[model samples]
Target: MRHYDLVILGTGSGNMLLDEEFDHLRTAIVEPDRFGGTCLNRGCIPSKMFVITADAVEDARSAARLGVHAHVDPVEWKAVRDRIFNHIDPLHDSAVNYRREKGVDVYIDEGHFVAPKVLEVKGEQITADTFVVAVGSRPVVPGTPGLDSVNYHTSDTIMRIDELPASMVVIGGGFIAAEFSHVFSAFGTCVTILQRGPRLLTAEDEQVSARFTELAAQRNRVLLNATVTSVEPHGDGVSVTVACPDGTHVIEAASLLVCVGRRPNTDRLDAAAGGLELDEHGHIVTDSAYRTSVPGVWALGDAVNHFQLKHMANAESRLVRHNILHPEDVRTLTNRVTPHAVFTNPQIASVGLTEQEARRREMDYLVNVRNYAATAYGWALEDTTSFAKILASPADRTILGAHIIGPQAATLIQPLIQAMALGSTVDQVASGVLYIHPALTEVVEQALLAL
Candidate 1:
């Protein structure tokens, strides 16, 4: 049996566990696919790259409205797609090489939990004093009729298309669906989004989701509260049938893309063999310290079934690493107000409570709304979009929540996240020192003032 101090199940956050502090220990990193995992290769980086390019193209096309008379030349699909992959492909190699150089055993095969403290790597039993299962998640394709016969793309494979389809029909109205709708629409494709809910971004605050739905309707076709029946090939394209409250409708497009959601990659690990229990969603059950039911075994990231964002995954990984080493002072993942951002054109970022969430919890709160056009930078950019910066409180103005919409919404929401994480009051956030004038951050300052 091969032995090591640590046996990381997956490569994504697994690599992050290798700290200078752990240099004295022998480590084995097992990853079946490419090294950087989903985020670096297919999920976050590549998708954002496409989103940025789509944004630039859309802006150029809209410039004529401002009398700029600028025109965007045709997007070179091959060149653009290749450029993004070219930059990302190398990082995977570097990560693998760096670990090998550091004397860490890197297994490029699947690792399954065979026994409580044993892992089976490529049919070989390997034992470790401690283990971390960082196996991430993959896009979930709904089991719709005729889905197999037709060519459908998920978040993973959609970005690798040879060229943007002239028109596409997207399934689901979550973040992936909304973001990809914007990207394809901006690229001059006829985009249609079919949502299973009443609005897009169902996971976000209701107000934010409603506003996003309104804004998205301006750029593409959005069908909400619709249930998809099937997808079938029609000539060179495909047609989707959906059943709604009123009746069934047929929508035709050149391509069909599914962005419903993701499922944790725990099945392949045979977690049951390790005595680790999983929830209904197939995610491993873990305590705050990222520990499983069995001793010496832990799970983090998407496998834990908590927050699936990359930042959250990395944070959980760090916490797991510390707890495993110390074991004395175990830290919980609670109390940290996680922030999320959608890469749509104007972007949407939020942290802490939503307006409805605050009210539901029966917390007395204050809501504030702001417009991008009200700011100088907004005027310079001829902005017409609206954004709300909500500061909720329990009559004491403790700053329970903050949400932002419009340009750079993600960047503007960071300070609010810091405030929430630190339990800073609204007064503290408002009184905090901020640089003056000629900055987009002034929007945050203005919103805080309203609070």
Candidate 2:
């Protein structure tokens, strides 16, 4: 048996802990998968790289509307896939090597707690004075009948396929489904989405969800209120049987991509063995300081957060680091504002409460909506369906929430996120700030001004 001053159970955001400051402490990191975590290996970063290419194709397709007729060539799937992994894999290897060279016991194996403060990895039992669990989540695979028998892909495996699927039947309508749909569809692959809900991005403001669903339906075959009952291997592809509100339908496609959601890896960690409390969803329970039920055991990242966002995990990691180092003077995380964006076509981003939530809570809030068509940039791009929706407190005029859909929606939502983080009012965010004339960001300013 060996012991460590600190042992980070997962290498995702947990990787942030071992720095020059922790040099004096004996540290170790355990990870059976990639070192940089989901975001770097298969989630945010690689998806965006694929999106940029998809966006270029989309731009060319829509270029005729700008009076600049343009054409796009077929996307080389292998080349794109190879180029991405070629870059990302080296970085992952380098991280593993760098940490090992630093005398950190980099265990490239899955580990779980066998007893309080003790973990077992590759037949080795190690105890740590303090443990950090950042092992992220994995894609949720719903038990559709015969699904296990057929070959299907999740967000984890879909990006690395050898060839771009000719036609895909996508199950689920969240950000993951929307993103890959945009990528493959832009690359000339046919896409069909099966959403169990009435709309896509149900978490976003109602207007944004409605607008995105409307736009998405135009680009791909979207079956709303769809329930997938079963899947089976058929021919060279898969056959999906869906029960819709109207009737049941059997759809065949070259590939089946499931993007229902993700569940935390806490189950694999055997969190109970460590005396860690977990929610019903298997997420490690934590306080504002990222401390678990057991003392000396702090957790962060997807395992501890249902948000499952890399940026959010990073924020939690920072807080946990401080709390572990200064146990006597522990400071709780204050900034609770979380912002998220989907990099699909007519990109979507949102932060804070949705109007439905405010209405349900009976909060006194003012709301405004500004369409891209109302701005100079919108006219230049001939954008008609995109808009920004903002909500603010009527009393203090503090920006409560903001949602955007359209070009640069991800980029445009940053200022609103900043305003919320700073607790700034609509006037403070928009009234005094100068926006570049004719820029798309003016759309956000317009929405705030209206509020």
- Candidate with the greatest TM-score versus the true structure: 2
lDDT per residue for candidate 1 within 1-451, as digits (tens), equals: 9988888988877678887888899988999988878888888888899999998998888887678888887788778899999999988889889988998999998888778888888789999989899899998978899899898999988888997799999998988888889888888889999998998998788878888899899989888899999889999889999998889999999999999889999888888888998999999998778899988888998988557799888888888888988889988888678888999966999887887777788777787877777678777778776575676674666777777778788888888888777777777787777646767777777777887
Q: Kindly report which residue stretches of model 2 are placed more than 4 angstroms away from their true locations once superposed.
A: none
Q: Model 2, poorest ten-residue lDDT window?
A: 302-311
Residue range 1-451, candidate 2, lDDT tens digits: 9989999988878998878888889999999999888999989999999999899999998999878998887888999999888989998788988998888988998998899998999899999999999989999988789999899999999999998889999999999999999999999989999999999988888889998999999999999999999899999999999999999999999999999999999989999999999999999898888889999999998898778888899988888898888889898878888999999998998899999999999999999999999999999989889999999998988988888999998899999999999888899888888999899998998998887
Per-candidate TM-score against the hidden true structure: 0.96, 0.98
lDDT of 2: 0.91
Q: After superposition, how far is residue 167 of candidate 2 from its true place, in Å?
A: 0.4
Cα RMSD (Å) per model?
1.6, 1.0
TM-score of candidate 1 versus the correct structure, residues matched by position: 0.96
Pairs clashing within candidate 2:
none
Error of 1 at 130 (Å): 0.6
Clashing pairs in 1: none
